[model samples]
Target: MGVRGLTTFVKNPSYTHDGSTTLLRPHQLSNTPVVIDGKGLLQWLYFENDVDCKHGGDYREYETICTEFIEALHQRGVKPFILFDGASNPDDSKVDTLLGRCRERIQDSAKIIDGDPESPKLRPPFTTAVFLKVLESKEVGYVFCDFEADSEIVALANIMGCPVIGNDSDFFVFDLTGGYIPLSSLRWKEARQLSIPCEKYSLDHFCQAYSMRREMVPLLAILLGNDYVSRETFDDLYHRVIKRSGNIPNGPNVRIPRTIRFLQSRQNFADGAKRLLKDEARRQGKEECIEKSLQAYHIAPESRYQAYLQQDPSMVDIPDCPLPAAYVDLYRRGAFPADYINLKFRNNRKKLLPNLVEDYIRPSCHLISQRIREAIYGILLHGLHDRAVQETGREGQDIKVFIVTGMPSLPEFGSLPNLERMIDLEEERRKVLVMEVLEVDHGRVQAIRDDLKLPVATTIYWRSKLDLPVTESGHHLMRVILLGIAICYSREDLNMDDVKGNLKEAPRVMNRTAVQAFAEWQSCMYYTMHLNTLVNRPYPTPDATKLYHGTLLHRIYATTRLQRDVNPDWVETDVLRGSPAALALFRHLDGVAQNQ
Candidate 1:
């Protein structure tokens, strides 16, 4: 029988009554022997130091969950097996100690075996050492696996065959498709059910169904948007455009007044010190001594410092202010100050504060909006439409889809009726009959019955606000197109040659230039805003020139123009490209293109 459990039981051979009067034979006969293998099931669980455990609860909770799960399996006639990392918890060493106690408690009733006999069970070895000595002396069937070191020990059950059991999804992610079976939640029900289909899903089928490129999930995440670059870039670009346009209206003149006051205060301090020194010189009976004393400190024989002090001594001793050491250190370390850091730390914090706020915080707030757009694109590409075709092996002429956005009364729905009417008009006039928008609404969508009035089979609602820039909209649309292509290719099992052939004859909706331009614009804007915040603020940097060469600005301009052509009334493009901002953006683009 295939059993999934915490441990394998070795039947005591001494209890057998087969006329072989041997003690081992009797014990083996009395119990149906099974050996639990730890090695085979190591991939099912992840062992990390307690510090890395982000989920709620401690090692005690983990032990409780495991124990309960194992007990439930035992009640269902399925054997339970337990595996543990030899390493103790980082925070508390007692995790391993407590687990050893649990193992001893269960071992008296069930089959008990030591994985590593030599390894000390406690910090100061005691009971486990005594137990190991007893088991070894008797020559019992208990096998001690060679797990002396701190590495993960894999115990392979010696029984002919056994089903591996676990509820961890990481097993599927890792593509462990051997004799594995899920101990599903349904197993805990009052009426135990044994004949469940616990077959491992084929990795190839999972990848194909999801339209995932081989081992490219991390890459896709980076491209779509990640915490590191995309967010930072968008923030940078937004601040740059805002700063260059001088749209911020609230603050005092950060540059002129502060500089003047700061300089004048230093000048007053220098003058006061000079006057006091002159008084000291006069008191010491040397009328010309103050000049000679100041002269001694001058670097040059013909000192500009002396000359400056003679003319305006108050302003002369003001220090030559270099950039802050902390800022320089941060720059060398390749970390830009976050918005809060810029606002709080460094000298001249006020001057650069607005840029940081606009760049970092504003862009971060929009990440969810961007993700929502990407999710919409994902749904259109990989959701039920592709699955229906793949499973049925039939590509229907018209696929009905329902997109539920959960927005009850968005203003954008007002335009949907007109869009649907236009699609109907175009289908009749062109006779192509390729695509259609069947229905438009701003409320919860219900399935269409045979007698329903709705003409379109697929229903998609717009729940979120649609305030995204035209460039972003175009980028999203391109992703949708790519997803559509991927889905078609995935379903048809088309080879590279077949895909190329289809591409050649595929209806050209958007040109390469237009698509490229939109992508470039989005990237540029993101970077430009990011750089402006880094430079204008008290952020650290080694080489500001190397940082802001304008590749991003160039891309933004090119992409924005393309986006403008596609949708003329987008105010963001106009706002972003206003006089000074436009000149700065164009200058950067020109520099990059020339270098290219």
Candidate 2:
């Protein structure tokens, strides 16, 4: 979707990273806003749960994704600026195609829902009105782009000298040089701050990787097609006006390299497109092909930019990268050219531009990956706060003990002998948190829970649902153990005596899908913890399979997080909010099966 065939053609993805997988602390930078993509965040929220909102969810359903994410950033000392795309698409040509794809996905969703338990469920993309309203409710800063938010976000990131946080790889095509973060990498896994580098890829590295001039990349994208334009459509446009001199055999992906060669020849797009068309026509004996190819060229890139910008002019007035509506005119008038090759030598730089011919991806590029590693730990309650306080001492309170379960025992399904090595691997990097995995596994959850003498604040970082289909008894047992600890300390905030007596009065929770039910579970947990009435909540009831799900882990931690609240006794809902599992954590398939 980025530059259709670009990622594959390049062979080498430009990136840099430190060998360490430990989470990074967010540094407070003045005048730098962490740009967020609203639609991307919505998907993260929807998928993080067992929720099935594919038929499309309403405002009340998805509002928490915004509220929780904003607060998470604030807590880490980041000023997040949100961006949403408007309902207008300047190019109407794509609606039918986009709708077609959406319909296909919706059909798939229906099959998944009505068919097998293992069928993959997909949510359909919808308008942003509901998400925008939530942003307004919280009084957060945001802007609706005229067409799409990709270019706007990149422009803003460059203007602010900050980082763009999103999942879209198209930012690579935009030449987002200053900074970029995939939104999925910012989720809360182990309660760590999201740390990503300021620069994802520079122009130099991109050119080197693709083995072509900079201008050719976008041209290749036009030929290969991107989100706005389909590759088949672009090919059709090219085939319509062309005369075949001889019916040459079409080999595998021969056009991609040929297009790259054609684009690279002229150094400038306008000159190159005309020249390529001319070259083709001379060989085919149809001189008219050049004119037809040029016409097709004008529709894309600029019109792609225009259709998006004219829908909303206020986009240009953004505080960070305020460009007037005139730029779109400039774009259309052919004032702007994708001339990376010529500009490199013409103006000239003292040094050749950046390229990663090195083994390590530059540390700057992998900042989000490292940050995501830590976030997953925190979100998963892998003693993230405990570790953060040890390193930063910002959180006044910390965990005295960890009740971690689901340590990797079997190596055959592909867990390794080195628990320490798990942190080095990408899959376990998000889920596994251990100084030494073997030591933790040896300690055992029951042993730790039974020992009970070593702690004031305790937490669970168990891989329950991921490990097994949890039963009702399992949930009750986990609740009893944690509540027993609370009762032991006589944590008056939980109203131990009162909640113990009122536990029976807590209503039965049902009548909702797993996603909605989990949301309610999270919401209730937040309220209960914010109100300091954890004990008043019902005892955990394990459903044989449902209780085994890790969704309840979020519920439990939301309640426990109040212990770190500035005023644990007072209602501070601001600090207790929803989480983005996509950003902060990742899971491994190795130990997730029935036996695991």
- Each model's C-alpha lDDT? 0.26, 0.36
Clashes of 1: 45
1-596: candidate 1 lDDT, tens digit per residue: 01111111111111112322211111100112222222222212212112102110122223333344334444445543332222122222132333334344333211111222232211100112222222233322222211111111112221223333444322222232233344332234343344222333233433343333333322222111221213222233224432343222434322212222222233435555345434544554533434532321222212122222123323212122222443333222223222212222212111110110011112221232232222222222222222111110001211112222311112332221111132234322211111111123312212322211111111011112223444455333332222222222232232424323322222122232323322222332233223322223211211211111122222233344434322222311342223343334323322222222
Per lDDT, the best of the predicted structures is 2
Candidate 2 global CA lDDT score? 0.36
Please give each candidate's TM-score.
0.17, 0.40
Task: Give lDDT tens digits, candidate 2, residues 1-596.
Answer: 24565444333322212222211223323234666776676666666654533222332334456566556666656766666553223333344455455445434443443444554545422213345445556655665554456666666666566676765555555555454555444544334554322324444555554455655455556556555445554454355532121233466545555554444444555565656544644565544433432233231222122333334333243222222344322222222111111111122111111111011211211121222223222322222223221111001111111122222222322332221232234533311222122112322332222223111011122213112122222333234233333332233334434433322321122112322223222222222121111111111211111112222232333343334221222212222112122111111111111122
Worst 10 residues of 1 by lDDT: 352-361
RMSD values, in order shown: 35.2, 24.1
